[model samples]
Target: MRYIFILTVLLLSFNTFSQPISWVEQTSGLTTQLTSVSVVNDNNAWICGYAGRVLRTTNGGANWVSVNAAPIPLTLDLHSIFAIDSMTALVAGSGSSSFLFRTSNGGANWTQVFTETGGFINSVQMGNAFAGFMMGDPVGGRWSLWGTTNAGLTWDSTNFYLPQAGTEAGWNNAFFFEVTSGVWFGTNNTRVYKSLTLVNWTTQPTTGQVNSYAIWFNTPLTGFTGGTALLMTTNSGLTWVSPASPLPGTANLSGITGFGSQWVVTRQASAIYLSPDNGATWSTSYTAPAGNFRHIAKSRANNLIYYGVRSNGGISKGTLLVGIEPVSNIVPDKFELKQNYPNPFNPNTTIEFSIAKNSIVKLAVYDALGREVNSLLNSELKAGEYSINFSAADLPSGTYFYKLSTGDFVQTKKMILVK
Candidate 1:
């Protein structure tokens, strides 16, 4: 029996996958919930929270030094954190003053950008280095999403939804995984909604009511929002499913992140759970010493998973979860990988595809001579359709072939490169 168990562990480890998470402590050592976290490369990350505080990490999360950015610390409570670049960031705190701050030199220092003096910011995501947005629950009149394209210099408004009786028009929070893929969720009437650009927004039906935070799409189509019962989605936000979460009862789900195959979920004071099978099941990672989870992020540049609780300081990891699901149902019609947009482009183009199930797949670009130049689908993919940008800045204008291969199934298409 011991050998069998060992073999199973070995097999699961070999697959592109997940493992449990372990974390250290923060410096300030506040037992308050550390609400938000963001990581770049492996060393740089930022965590924000209650009492108008933001914590920065340069050595992953081994240790953290608290940065008191707010002029008036006790006035606002930060709810969300977004790092567009090493230096550029946007922080949303509770209350009307959307405490928007920016750092030019990788958080060494920060400057106050814009402050929405009325409604508090619930969540924030960078649309680009220049453009980003912040969302909050219905406040003042009827506004949900706000956009800033000029490096927080100016703004635009969006009605995430108009308040309805049973259906609240406003969102509890908002976060963007990419320039296109974004999600906005709330408590009372509004559950959550999704959008590609900042333009058209669609409400995604969640399992139950969520109050806290959510982490979405390790890659698109696969996302988990932390709320009532760990709401999950296989299709970006086309549909939402309520899965059995690790929390004991009706608890607010906040921080969530994925490393390798393991996903970590945190609730206030509740032990974090690491899942290998896409949240189908969950186990403990580490019990938070105190505080509630507010934000989480996985550094793609490196494998570090950074986390922040309401007031637990901020912690980060150099390694990530390693549990992966089996490659299943390699069915063609089950998925639809769209052709590259602007087939005959000079520098950049977009490639889109869909998967019916989670699997380790390969997507590569080949020149007309059959020599492979680039590969995109090189990691474990969650079930859903997605589009990725393929920038050909180094290649000459010509014809190329981009293909998708999984197990024995292979598909290829011809693309023209016009410089």
Candidate 2:
């Protein structure tokens, strides 16, 4: 399965401010400090943590099975995990000799893919099914960066380029990668390094912040990094600034992930903060009863559902009630495509539509030449009124066309981008 880390910008027509999120704590049946969580889909998920503990849930966290039995060392503290599916995954652990393990048979057997003595692998991310990257602490003054093009079957340490590290180290799960956007990672030295080409590098200081442990981007030009403090950027990473209001807690942020205007972050404390309007403001969405959260992840198949792992073996499943709610109880009599809000939009706009019956709908944007550019919606939705927000930050200013299509219905409209 190819995993592409692209944040799709689409908002359903609902009052997100009043949308209630209900979180239920799932039973992990362990007490170890869970470090990272990965949601492959709505039904499959994985969590890794200390003592080489790895857990898997195939039925949407209704039951979690322990997959760390044989051939997996009990002393390794697994820091990060990338789940390709329920039966295949790659996990990296930090120790005197850092190790990367890949399991193809649901963790019943494992193969050591990469190992480096005196190294600590912090993050492992796959851009797609074939290409991936892994980063560890500086080894012998050079960043221990590895790239793999064969789906983690083998890894290459050389040929891939990175800058030297001068006594700085990266935090666990502190990296972001998008095939078209490049890679970024934060460090303990108040600096974040970015490379568009993966060879030429540049650094930007997160001024006044000592550490940046978590980083996420909604678009190529908008992102956020958090640790001891929270910093945001509107023009990529060229500049960073703190939000107008501070996060609810004083603890460091350990995980960050979201889609569209909805943002979620897990702090070192018991609370998970959420921003309904892109990172401008935050409010406490859920507070655990016992330990702090170490990592949070959103489902790739469903944006409204996410999972957060705690420091005490607790997994919380949160569901956001932000789906396409009907404008009224009555279903529409005919299909309609409304004009996009704030036409001649500057980088962002909302397109509304309605369907007369349940159908598989597709809404997409096209360039002036009728080439498909962005796919906003392509799913089986019930008959209702819906609106989706689209971002054109990565597109040049020009005239664009948006088309809505179903099995028996099709419509197209024009919109303009000013900048």
Candidate 3:
């Protein structure tokens, strides 16, 4: 089953693998082809698809309401919806020449802020209202990038261009977001590009067409992108290479992104895939909100991944767990388990810890009694950094004990909790 989750608040001090959760169906009315799903935070999200279809819900994915947008004889195909903030957003699509829609009230109303210079506006992105760029297929199959400085009220039309661009049909998607710095991707020399000022589309040459069928970045450098083959670039798009993945037999990838720690990708159906180590490998257990999932969105706020799938057999709801993020603040404040961060904690926490040498580190927790209650970290850990989590919902709420053991280094700490 697929679920489009929405959380209200996010308290992130660290990044860690979060406990697994499922997606819940909030709305079951429309059946148009979903174009883009944008999530600003946990509780705020917007999804726009085909035939002037745009849905908004502030209550996560449990409920949805079509923005009964003030009638304007909806003409342009609303292919994408980008929630820049809970109030601000931008959307664009193909039909009716090419157009963009902006909203400052969570879709309560929308404004046709921009239109095409003659081409199907495949995707739309904005660094700010004063700085924006739109790219799409040209008349002769090539692609062009247009920029703006006046809140998209007017565009500069042409600054970056890609010759003989491939058809966006059946091709993956592209996105320009602020990750570490200004990052952009689509296909350039038939590959991809990354720019700082959204100009001078620097070509990061690659060997694959539609290499990043679906691309997403976390930092300007460290990101996971995939197409026919899964790819990971640690230094922006300067270099490109494929990673060895255990995906379900070279599955046709539709979209890819970094959620929490693992890399999430959608197959064709409601089925999805996950990679834990930057696409070097994959897991078959990954799942998202159930349905004939057409699109998915993830919010860094609450470590939740949502999906918009076709409610199977008359549009029903389902859920799936497709990826894992590290548990933020998983390390006991008094115990110490700090490693790296950006994990998928239920509430998005970070954990850090240090071990001297190899030992039987049993960071277990017991509920009330001294009996072995639950094992948060029960493995032969190395002598380096360690991070783990005692899932909030996995165990009951009460006094818990975390004991670490080595040869001569054995310590136990007590911690309190409130659900």
Candidate 4:
């Protein structure tokens, strides 16, 4: 059975093999599609889209302010953006007359960094505050790549690697920048370009012919590149192995990003897939909140994951009630038993409970006939939030009940297991 779940502040939650994550919507005050997002931190981010659109959030998306680009034409589609801080960022627009804009005064002023006629910019990335790179569609049989050592003040266009002989171009949000000066970009050539030392670049073919739209690397040695299916690499991009697609065989992956050690992949408006063990196995954690999910960003300061939608004109914040992060920092004021996530679960789920004061806690699950099937926990507790995993690998799928008892507080919640 398909399972859909939601979480509350009480902290009672669960996760079967198929657990749903809660996505909270953020108002962008615009309806245009936000195609790119660069999360500077938990409280600062920059989002860009069509019509020279740029949105900045400094207070963790509670409030978003618009950064205007008046001199630049509004009809151009700003498909790629890189935010260095609250006041400084770079946005690239794709069209017949592609242009790149930079702002240093928090949008009070804007400057045109570079422009190319009859070209389209697909991705832009910065390795440091003063160094960055940009890629455009093939021009004269060579993909356009430019480097800048002095921020956007000057760009060097003659220092590109040997060009391949094809109409090789890049997809939106297909670029990745590693801290060790590694750069990777997916292309319509069904190949991935990797620059181990940033001085030279090499292209490696993927297992499938579909264009890779998104790419992520947990470490320089481990990464996942997705197009029609998922390809994983353990020894960097030297080799890749095809993993089972998280969605059905027909769905194409739209975007992928990393949240701490966990990974997330989106399939447009259909679903969001989560991988707890790097790129090994994935499960459906939630459906797309709005429109089609184009990209997702995670804040390095607080590790908050944010989703940007295509044509939805808004962004959404999400929280994981299972996997690594079970709850935020808000502690409960009283002992309570909350609901389990993905109540109609499959082979696995999570159980969360809170204690207001230190007490002996006991948790056990029983079958529909009141027979105990599993003892999840029996521990000396603290006045904090705690969660435990409950895997029904050996139990038959059916109705099950879980009870929590601690001092005078005793409560039970019913869950369904459908294998």
TM-score for each model: 0.64, 0.73, 0.64, 0.72
Work out how many backbone clashes candidate 3 has: 55
Report backbone clashes per prediction.
Answer: 31, 0, 55, 5
Off by over 4 Å in 4: 1-22, 179-181, 244-249, 259-261, 320-419
lDDT of 3 at 41: 68
Better of 2 and 3 by lDDT: 2
lDDT of each candidate versus the true structure? 0.59, 0.81, 0.54, 0.72
lDDT of 4 by residue, 1-419 (tens): 12222222223333312223445567888988888888887678888988878888877777888886676577888999888777888889978777889988777778998988877888887877888888777776777788888877777787575485566777877888865848888888778888866568887788665588888887777788878778887788888777544434346667777644467777666466676566555655445446777777665455444555566885766544444334444556888777877678887787777788755566778899999765454433445576656678778889999999887699999999999
lDDT of 1 by residue, 1-419 (tens): 00000000122223344533335445655655567776766667777777877776676554677665535356777767776665666666766556666666655566776566666666776656787777765555655567777777566784454443353544323355466555454444435656666566666666555443555566676777755667676777666676654444456665666743457666655456667777656555555555555555677465545554544553434244233233443333465557888878877787766666655556778989999776443444445454556778778889999888765457888889897
- Candidates, ranked, TM-score: 2, 4, 1, 3
Candidate 3, TM-score vs. the true structure?
A: 0.64
Task: List runs of model 3 lying over 4 Å from the truth.
Answer: 1-21, 68-76, 128-130, 139-142, 149-151, 161-172, 188-190, 208-211, 249-251, 259-261, 285-291, 300-302, 308-419
Find the candidate with the highest lDDT and give its number: 2
Candidate 1 regions exceeding 4 Å error are 1-17, 29-33, 70-74, 106-109, 158-174, 210-212, 244-250, 259-261, 310-318, 321-419
Is candidate 2 or 4 superior in lDDT? 2
- Measured by TM-score, the strongest candidate is 2
| Model 3: per-residue Cα lDDT over 286-319, one tens digit each | 3334544444556645444445444231121213
lDDT of 2: 0.81
